[model samples]
Target: MAHTLAQKILQAHTDEAIMAAGQIVRCRVSLALANDITAPLAIKSFRAMGAKKVFDRDKVALVMDHFTPQKDIDSAQQVKLTREFAREMGVTHYYEGGDCGVEHALLPELGLVGPGDVVVGADSHTCTYGGLGAFATGLGSTDVAGAMALGETWFKVPPTIRATFTGTLPRWVGAKDLILRLIGEIGVDGALYRALEFDGAAIEALSVEGRMTIANMAIEAGGKVGLFAADEKTLAYTAARGRKDAPLSADPGATYERELTFDVSGMDPVVACPHLPENVKPVGEVRGVTLDQVVIGSCTNGRISDMREAAEVLKGRKVAKGVRCIVLPATPGVWKEALKEGLIETFMESGCIVGPATCGPCLGGHMGILADGERAIATTNRNFRGRMGSLESEVYLASPAVAAASAVAGVIAHPGSL
Candidate 1:
């Protein structure tokens, strides 16, 4: 009985001896997460369900990363309610203020999620944890509430799509380019309701941080979850964070509904054009698209590696006049590391503003909202219409390198072009 990595992880959390794709199964949750935007609704749902206390206080995490620092009265109220609920429930992982980063990044960094775990969050990027060989996905607030109350949630197993990446990535091109290329080829809904299993030499060669970036954007292609088999790199990363879970991998004869292969050896830095993650083009093709803002951070590309790359590009260079460049480290630890390594100074010297670690401008929350008709090149995950501000504003999604280069060029330009 061969099983895909996703199937194996899901089955491991359930009592079922054998599980198939599409089977309805209730599995224990290793971690349940909700951010400020979603936690309030989940708290209301938790109360509506008459759950006085969470199923496992230690397993539930309430993060105030989205609209934190009190954007407005409404947002402040939302956090207040969530904070009160967290205090009342004695949830062990409540995070806010300086302790909060993006939930997807913070959870893995805190060692709260690991291999063979089933994690659910009220936000879509929860799938980001699959990079650690965990079965993680996004659920609605109510479903998250159920997981909080019962320590479990039901999932309709998604069939697997195995995507193999071969060859080496070009300079200035990495995980962000790979994902943008895939989405452009397959459109936004290509892998709808399917589990994306990534493998092959190139994927294995990528750093764990890069793997998390790829997995973080799985939802852009409508994937139920994106998984990478737990390997030495993954284990070492988790071990460094104090998690020692056993590595998980798919059986050799594992089944997959579809197979896709990508040879990235010849790929160049790419960007998801305005309005959609699927609307992508090579950076060279879209060169000279003027920009008003350039943001180089998000759960997708706000890690220390991302900051280092951006800093490398911005070193001794100034952001183009009239362009507002904002850099956000994904978490507090990432921020501290960047500061210690002088990446923060590089960004500031380049005329870029270094903001606290928050989802802020990525979700149009605040800190760097765009004006109407303005354009931005960002290293964030999505770029739907009005994602960063006014409905007339536009967002181009690219890797941190491209975003940094574009900030200097005042247009969508390649790093090599600079």
Candidate 2:
């Protein structure tokens, strides 16, 4: 049977030689992840299970990124507990302070993720690793604890859904638009518990960063993973990161339960407007939409490459007169790299305020909150009704390029002209 990338990776982790959708299967997890927010709960549960140590100390990665430099008393306590738990558990891959960032970005960059592996993280965006042809999915804290105590987890092999994108995307239409369009077609719960595999020329034309951006939002569409076949771009990315030995591609003739085709040749930049992440519409259709704030950062598109794309459009321009634009790096490593590349200068010169390498406005804990009737265009993942600020405010989600261009124009503008 021909299997999609997600199917191939899932099958590789299964104990059975063959499996099908809805069938229970035990999988051998290659790696498990927990960040500051989830690690404390996971540790508490693991201790409750009477586990002396993690099944494999090196197999688990504990990162402190969410509240790194702790914003409040509760967050400070969470970080303290997580650090103590990691050290006591003998977890060798603990990352704290400046070392912490978004878990997904750090994992692949550090060569911790590879093809044909099953990776799980407490964060929903763990599906991002599917870009590497890995069977990655998000789990709750209890699941993380179970994986810590026993290096295995059970899954009901998800049915496969294929999205074949044809034609070339316009200059401003990016991976974010592609995913948003798909979500618009299928709605939020359409792909619940399903594995989505992207195919065709359009997907192949996308860069690794773009593919990652697409995969990172799989959860928004209720998918287990959103994957693309490992191709030259994937190989080049891994190689440049000094992980030339990672596996590549799935077997040809992979099987899928269903498939969809999208013709995006002339597709315009799309935005997932507030109230729901899946409420999407083309930017042109929603032009003149005023915004009070704009934010560009998140695990979804906070890499150096992503920042450069946004900076390129903002080089000689300034943010809209009254609108505030906040830019954040996903990780300290990405922040350092951007500083070295002068991207930070470009952003500052363009009148964009830059924040530390924290989740920042993405998670709504700090910075860039909106007032009633206010609107914002952000590069972060979700746009649920009250995600960034007040429940009365509205958020429109787009790519880094679109967010940057909109920030400068004071309206929802495409990045194609810039």
Candidate No. with top lDDT: 1
For model 2, the superposed segments whose C-alpha errors exceed 4 Å read 244-247
Per-prediction TM-score to the true structure, in the order listed: 0.99, 0.96
Model 2 clash pairs are 2-253, 2-254, 2-255, 3-254, 3-255
Query: Whole-model lDDT for model 2 versus the true structure?
Result: 0.84
Every model's Cα RMSD, please?
A: 0.8, 1.6
lDDT of 2 by residue, 284-317 (tens): 7787888889998888889887898899899899
Q: 108-197, model 1: which lDDT tens digit per residue?
A: 899998889999999999999988888889999999999999999988888999999999887778999998888897889999999999
Candidate 2 vs. true structure, TM-score: 0.96
Which stretches of candidate 1 lie above 4 Å from their native place?
A: none
lDDT, candidates in the order shown: 0.92, 0.84
